[model samples]
Target: TNLEKRELVELSTRGLSRKEKLIVILYYLEELTMKEIGLVLDLSESRVCQIHHRILFRLKETLERMREDLLG
Candidate 1:
């Protein structure tokens, strides 16, 4: 079910703001380090980590909600 998992992640990303999406792409897709992401975003490394954590938490909630809706 890798395709389904990818679909769910795609759907969840739709709820992200522009900056959040950029951070996700830069970090995961582009394989950027936190320091590199911060340089690209003009933020400190700590801030990038904070944003990353928040994005992950939000995505987790969104994916869970989507799964529940589909199941129901």
Candidate 2:
């Protein structure tokens, strides 16, 4: 499962923009390459990579925040 899907399953609601969600689903769930995602999304490969990184970083941050909230 994609990170966002897992997060969404656990959290029920995702706090990301539409593009971020689409990127996550394509990259992780659909198992698409950056080039493939770019082609499908009408973005450049470099832009897809950037979006992937941003989505990953955002998910990580949200997970950390959730952990802190749970622990504290």
Candidate 3:
């Protein structure tokens, strides 16, 4: 679980867009709610939700590929 989280942080910071990175940092590291993030970013709450979902999906896919490579 920690490894996944670490991978998430590493991959997200490097691979995501600027807004996506800010969203991740505000949500995870700074512990902000989607509504709060939306306010800070001047986006709608739903948009923030979408970005968060997309970010997690990308992170998961990357981590899975890394795991498979390590195993193989």
Candidate 4:
């Protein structure tokens, strides 16, 4: 679990755009709601939701690949 957390921390920021990084930090570290995040970022709430979904998807895919590489 620790390793997973560490990997998430590392992967979440890697090669991310400024907006992506801000979204991650605001949502995870700052515990901001999507609506709040959208307001902070000057994006629509729906767009913020989309970004959050995409970010989670990307993280899941990346973590799966890392797990495969480690095991195989």
TM per candidate: 0.78, 0.77, 0.83, 0.82
Clashes of 3: 0
Model 4 clash pairs? none
Candidate 1 C-alpha error for residue 49, in Å: 0.5
Cα lDDT of model 4 by residue, 1-69, tens digit? 757755675667787778988898888767899999999999999999998898889888988999999
Off by over 4 Å in 1: 1-10
Residue 61 of model 1 has an lDDT of: 85
Query: In model 2, where do residues sit more than 4 Å from their true spots?
Result: 1-13
Q: Which candidate number has the best lDDT?
A: 3
Q: Candidate 3: lDDT over CA atoms?
A: 0.88
- Cα distance off (Å), candidate 1, residue 8: 7.5
lDDT score, candidate 3, position 71: 100
* TM-score of decoy 2: 0.77
Alpha-carbon local distance difference test for all models: 0.84, 0.78, 0.88, 0.86
Which candidate do you rate higher for lDDT, 1 or 2?
Answer: 1
Q: In candidate 2, how many Å is residue 61 off?
A: 0.9
Residue runs of model 3 more than 4 Å from their true location after superposition? 1-11
lDDT of 1: 0.84
Give me the overall lDDT of model 4: 0.86
Give the range of the ten consecutive residues with the poorest summed lDDT in model 4.
Answer: 2-11
